[model samples]
Target: MSRIAELTSLLMPHLMLAPIGLPMLTAALLLTMKEEQQRLKLGLNILSTLLGLLVAVALLLWSHESGAPATMGVYLPGNWPAPFGIVLVLDRLSAMMLLLTGFVALCSIVFAGARWHRAGVHYHTLFQLQLMGLGGAFLTGDLFNLFVFFEILLAASYGLLLHGAGRTRVQAGLHYIAINLAASSLFLIGASMLYGITGTLNMADLAQAIPQVSAADRGLLHSAAAILATAFLIKAAVWPLNFWLVPAYSAATAPVGALFALMTKVGIYTLLRLWTLMFSSEAGPSSLFGSLWLIGGGMVTMAFGAIGMMASQRLTHLAGHAAVLSSGTLLAAAGFGQNALTAGLLYYLPSSTLAVSALFLLADLIDRWRNDGASLAPYELDDVAPFLTPELMPTTGLNLDEDEEVLVGRVIPAAAAFLGLAYMACTLVIAGLPPLSGFIGKFAMLTALVNPLGLGSSAGTQPGLPGWTLIALMIATGLLALLALTRSGIRHFWAAHDRPTPQLRVMEGLPIAILLGACVALTLQANGVMRFTEATANGLHAPGTYVRAVMTAAPIPGPTTTPTPERAESSATTKAAP
Candidate 1:
């Protein structure tokens, strides 16, 4: 019974979802407010984000202090239990992912504050709902519950994708919605199959019960696993299944696009969690299902995404394609199935989320910057002048060299030039070229794949190494992304998109400085960061700590009946798990 209390405490952090959730709901409702009162929605939107940040921080503290896995409310509408009810589990990884989601969501909310409400119906509201779904996916332990969370996020995403209601965005969103809904249905079918075979909906219960499944059911189990994996792969943007991701991501807004950074990672998280846990057992000598397929497919997926990035043109489209590459990298790491790669994934997840979010937002600013300038490229630039007032082009312009003034449209400020440099620095780190978190993530992947003597060697014929090579070929793909970015950089400092550019403003430096600071800090703290990631990865693999926390207490004594007299034991045949 004490376990119940512990579970509730773990869920305390999830309450952070409410702050974002409520205002978003309010935004949807506030469409009734007179246009003159629209500021009310705006104020509430800002407040909701601030509230979410505080709650997320508080939850992080609670999780830290608890320092153990916990489960919360089996709470049901009619007090149902077991297969009839839903359950939420907060393990170490789940808690960490939730915290990261909250942090990134908070930042995106701040970015959208002034920009979103005017764009479409209940824009901020949908963003909040999306967060709710993301948080739920990380927190829920039940298969059906995860599906519900996945759908919730998709539901919100549909509106956000079409937020501006632009003809192109709306059409793209239709394809996105239709495709994802099919995936969701597949997820549900897979969940039903697992439940039918295992006779339990709880993940922990399934883990213990699946071991006892009959040989007759192995096909069912394997098929279910495959179907479930397909659903997540579709979500993860894996291989040929990922064709839809680029178009949808390209069509979305900067902040909306940034929000997607967490979406696919959530899918990858599900794959890693489900395969490494519940399904694969380290103690057993037998091979686990989908081990080779997942690893090999991951390699192909990485290559596909890299090719997409190389081929894409629009800056937004390029960033979207890069996400595909990142997805493949994540899959490759997970497929390697080594502790180091798993740990690297944990480390990579948050850093990449932040970097991607920052880049997407900056892409917007760059888009506007391009429109203003004219000359060399066919792309739009918001300005053409070499110098402008600080208000318009803060921390922007060409020729970031020390002596030359920073210019955007025409505004010049020393601080602004520093900001442009800062952005350049951040972009470099994200490309995995330097001492930043991305570099560390890549180093871990390389070690896991190529190390002849380490974890890779111990796992005979490991598929993860080949998978890593898939992304390695795309290492130059970052440069492809960098190529488009270089044009803007050159325009700001060396030349305008066409004519000489204008001075930049210090105000615009804010995001550039912040993103660069993250990269620099990540680079400096690589050691400590990698260590924690290792810890996270270890926890994910065995999840012994979590199992113990949930199932640890002495099992409740069941029956008072005496044991039956010993009978001849039958040699019951054992069946292989699917």
Candidate 2:
């Protein structure tokens, strides 16, 4: 075991590249295969996705190891020093996100294999490309690479959204493509402005430079940050900029929608990472920049999502709005900038994502059950009966012989039972009910808010009006979600009596089970998870650690060379003559 550990440590630097490299290689290999070779493609996709998940788990464990001198691992693809070559940093946050991406991708691909993968050409290839892009986005340590990966993912999503193309999907895909293109432009402009101001696009270098930037450039710097934030916020589905999210997400197929649950988090993750690194207390006169805006924007977004959830009639649309609500909560908590609150938000992130993803999958199954064989036959207008006619009046009671006994209850089918239980679990987590991870997470954040001083510290100042407002909003939104989901549940499960039972495949059902099971495990292990999150949050607030790790990471040394005797003699003669 010790020998294996030593070998792993030796290979750790190279292994950091696997998350991105493995998917790229797999996609390229998949592309070479013929369209009829779906079985092989499916097997390959599953194998690659599973391997990626294992790698992510290993990295996550490595990052969390207490004995390590530094938790962040820096890999230079080109063997050049920081700010000169491409770099990938594996830290707690990135590791967690990588694990999450892998888990969701595995589930999505498995679900897709049941049917959705065959919906169009290159589905597996596009899926792998999307994974590669997401992995790259999380691991990259610079702005240019971030933009590159963003485009990669966005391009892949365009094809995925339009897969099994229909009028609705085509329309939604066009809008999705157009909005993201604008966001990309904004992203490029913001990155360029920052590069012009700081003279480097490396995140750590930017952090170091921000403190020393000239006063004259400060305005420009903030403006660039704002523009960059606008792009991220749109991706995060913040209010007023989130008009594209529901239509796009709801229009997607089940597996794709489940995978897309992580898309918005990318935006939130970037905001959390950059805000702390570049605008923390160390940045004089720029400490906590845009904090108020985040708070205000987040509150408004929560309200909007709540209202949307209540208004939406479709289950898919309801899930989309729920995602928006989760984003709002995360954004607002980030704005608080408290270590405890940040820890709680980190804990909440995965819980909410898993629940929302499960809801998306579940929505599809429920819709099929409700609509299958339940469509009414069309009739001519002349055949319609008059409502006022007594003979055609609706009857309230069943007609039966007086001696017949009514059956008390009928046994529910296995499929219906599974759907009901899964739906109930999703509802509990999404609505932040007690005895689940979501509730625990919200409770932790609420505790942090009421205390206002650091967790376990002596009492100090209380949270301000913004904090109070966020608290109220959280409670209110959770209630609204509960109401909306309950209404949806009744309409789908109880209101209709003649709907046929859905015949669910193992691939379709197992993923939802696994996701909800994870939420259960999270609840059971909340203490350990919260501790990890607190450590991660602490590391995030300390910018110096990240900067030092990145800036001091040395490139791999070149091959050693031995000087020839002739060269040595020539050098000696030249030295003597001089």
Candidate 3:
């Protein structure tokens, strides 16, 4: 074999480490650079993000081609055994999330490059650190490590949230920071309690041990799980706990707001991961413990979010509420615990996230134009000359003040046209209207819920109330979003009085175009994307394949048999007491 081929083969096994490690290195490099080194900062940020995206895409394709979750990549750092040393599992779900994170981070970074990055110190450093945390969380197979990454990302987010110093930004950042600190405390307490009971922090190991939990300890275990679920639910922004989401996200600078979109989904991802792995049917009596609560809470969240969307007068707040609605829909589907529903969720997840992020960026641009003082004011009826079509007026008579009159009959500004079209695109996608990826994803979900059996199944099995309820709420929420977005659009686009056309730079506009273009591409390749999500859902429903894949990744150095219930109980007691 050629030298290059040999080197590639040698490094292939370690490729899984690149996503997390590369960003850490880049963040350190960025931290040491001087603040005024904008050129170096921009180049390094783009290079690191591009490399991360490439690696993420490679991992995604590798997982897809492998065709089975069990065959998905599993790398045991330091060649350590399962459930002992750190393990990184690259299954379909994680790979997909990694890809999404990389793509979103890339876009946000590029958009920030347009100017947001310079608003504060260490912007690039914090950005890279944020990616490091996000990447580590998605890749880590250990719960404790998940918490570590959670804090890492949260810390980075604190700095990024206040990146551009302003009164509104500082207040929002404080609220965000305080709420997350409490959540972190809950995370630690819950994780410690679980560790005491199960004597394991590795997710695969916990999955194996959950079914063997003694009845005497079930109450304590349930309490720990509840506490942990509460923390996750708060982050996921389920109704009552979602008060902080809008203010923080809406107040953030445009690029940072785009990054915050993924932060919300991280909570959803954690809930799905731990709940399915630890509380599935394989875990015996603990199976589907909070399913009903999840469904009901999710429904209520959707209702509340819909109300918020309707009440919102600003585009940013409207987008924020849309995120809350998206989380509710996904959480409810997850609560249903059906492979078909999950498949639809996987499809919808990316489509909704990307659409909402683009909306945040678009909102910033439109706001700039509406508030800019230098641009020409909107055309007024009083500023126009009443025309009788005599067509013989002197050219000098037509000459008027540039700012006060429209010499060339009403002309639509290019920036305004761009914003208008982008707004329409965002509305269609966020509202799940037809001919976009959003509609297809929701349609897939509706069809799956309505007909659990394949399309050719025999008659007599109708969808339950839960399924129909979900459908109704989804439609209602979409309509609410439509109404809210329409009002905001009209206020900004048509009914405007003295608003100026915002000057949009190519750099800023390009990122928005790329994100929307991606949505279009996802719609064009909907079939393939659906197939992949279907496979992902199937793998999630049957998690044994995942557990086995991780467990068998390396030698355990002992007997492979699971411990007996009595022995496991004795071990649990001994560990809990210690």
Which stretches of candidate 1 lie above 4 Å from their native place? 1-36, 61-85, 282-287, 373-419, 452-516, 551-578
Q: Which ten residues in a row have the lowest lDDT in candidate 1?
A: 374-383
Top candidate on TM-score is: 2
**C-alpha lDDT (0 to 100) for residue 526 of candidate 2:** 96
Backbone clash count for every predicted candidate, in the order shown: 42, 0, 0
Candidate 3: global Cα-lDDT?
0.82
Q: Rank the candidates by TM-score, best first.
A: 2, 3, 1
Candidate 2 structure quality by residue, lDDT tens digits, 1-578: 99998998889879999999999999999999998787699999999999999999999998988734338989999999999999899889999999989998898888777556765789999999999999999999999999999999999999998876666777888999999999999999999999999999999998999989899999999999999999999999999999999999988888999999999999999999899888887888777899888988989999999999999999889999999999999999898788888889999999999999999888877875675621111112122222112221223211122231221122235988899999999999988998889999999988899886748421212359988998999999999999999999998888988666675767778899999999999999998899888888887887788899899999879897786999899888999994
User: Candidate 1 at 404: error in angstroms?
Assistant: 32
Give TM per candidate.
0.78, 0.91, 0.87
Provide the lowest-lDDT 10-residue window in model 3: 374-383
Better structure of 2 and 3 per TM-score: 2
lDDT of model 3 at position 151:
92
Q: What is candidate 2's local distance difference test score?
A: 0.85
Q: Give lDDT tens digits, candidate 3, residues 145-169.
A: 8999999999999998887666676
Arrange candidates by lDDT, highest first: which order? 2, 3, 1
